[model samples]
Each structure stands twice: as C-alpha cells, then as structure tokens.
Target: SGVSCEFEENPCDSEPCLNGGECKGSQEFLHCECSTGYTGERCETKIDSCEPMPCYILGTESCEGESLSYHCKCLPGWEGNGIY
Candidate 1:
C-alpha cells in the first residue's frame, strides 16, 4: 500500500507582470493591478496621463488622469478655472 499528496503550484513564480505591478493569482492566469503612472493588461506600459497638455486656458490648467478619468490641475503660480 502507498499514499501520495498533491501540491498546488504558485502562479506568481514566473512573474508575468511588469513595471512593479502587483500580481494576483486567478484560476488560469494572473490579474495585474498597476501602480501609479502605469497601466495595461500586465502593467507593462507606462501611463501617459498628461497628454495633449490641456494648457489652452491661458496656459495654466494641466490635464492629468486619476485612475480612469482625467482632471485639470493648475500649474505652479496658476489658478483654477473654476471648471474642475
């Protein structure tokens, strides 16, 4: 007679994520939650939240992304346009 035990493998061992992304184990794959300034399926790309430079408002307001939404922030020594 003989007995055996099965051991589950750790999914994070291969480290599929990139750019300091936090890896979460799912059933068949990993779920990567990107850190600040990064976004993608594996967090392998850098986030460009400040694109197009929405500084048209007298060159004051700057556009940046907060999570999935964008917002305007006044530059140094600048004031808000009251539209935020």
Candidate 2:
C-alpha cells in the first residue's frame, strides 16, 4: 500500500524563472514567458501591442490615426459620414 499526498503544490511558488517572473513548468522550469503587453503574476493582463493605423473612407482621401484605429477619408463629392 502507498500513501498519496492530498495537498497539491502551487506551481507559481517555485523560483521557476531567473528573471523573477511566474513560472509555468511542464518540461522546463519556465515554459511560457510573458510578453510586455501582458502583466500580473500569471500574465492575465491584456494590452494593445499594435500601433494605430490610418483609416481611409471608401470614397474619400482624408485619413487619420486613432488610439487603436484610424479615421476614413470621404469619397470625391458624395459624403454623409466619414465612416460607413
């Protein structure tokens, strides 16, 4: 007969990585590394890692960049709103 340990160990408690980051061990001490766009001990934070791009209206020529997006340029003469 053998005794089984009922309590499981917290994987993150170990010094898994040398960079002082949380570890997710499978084969190695630290399997997955967190990106700069993510935070938290488990990297639960999500960040926008992409730069804003310019948006142009279907028929227009005007264009602008936004925080996470861009504006559209209106077409030649027909215009109601820059965005359709």
Using lDDT as the measure, which candidate wins?
Answer: 1
Q: Which stretches of candidate 1 lie above 4 Å from their native place?
A: 1-5, 57-84
* Predictions in order: lDDT: 0.68, 0.49
Give the alpha carbon lDDT tens digit for every residue of 14-81 in model 2.
55443334567742244536655555555565543223323433565665543344456666676655
Q: Ten-residue segment with the worst summed lDDT in candidate 1?
A: 1-10
Which clashing pairs does model 2 show? 57-72, 57-73, 59-75, 60-73, 60-74, 60-75
Top TM-score: which candidate number? Answer: 1
Expressed as tens digits, the lDDT of each residue in 1-84 for candidate 1 is 124546556677778789889899954777988888788898977765546554456745557665445667766776655243
lDDT of 2 at 84: 26
Lowest summed lDDT across 10 adjacent residues in model 2 is found at 48-57
How close is each model in CA RMSD to the real structure?
Answer: 6.2, 9.3
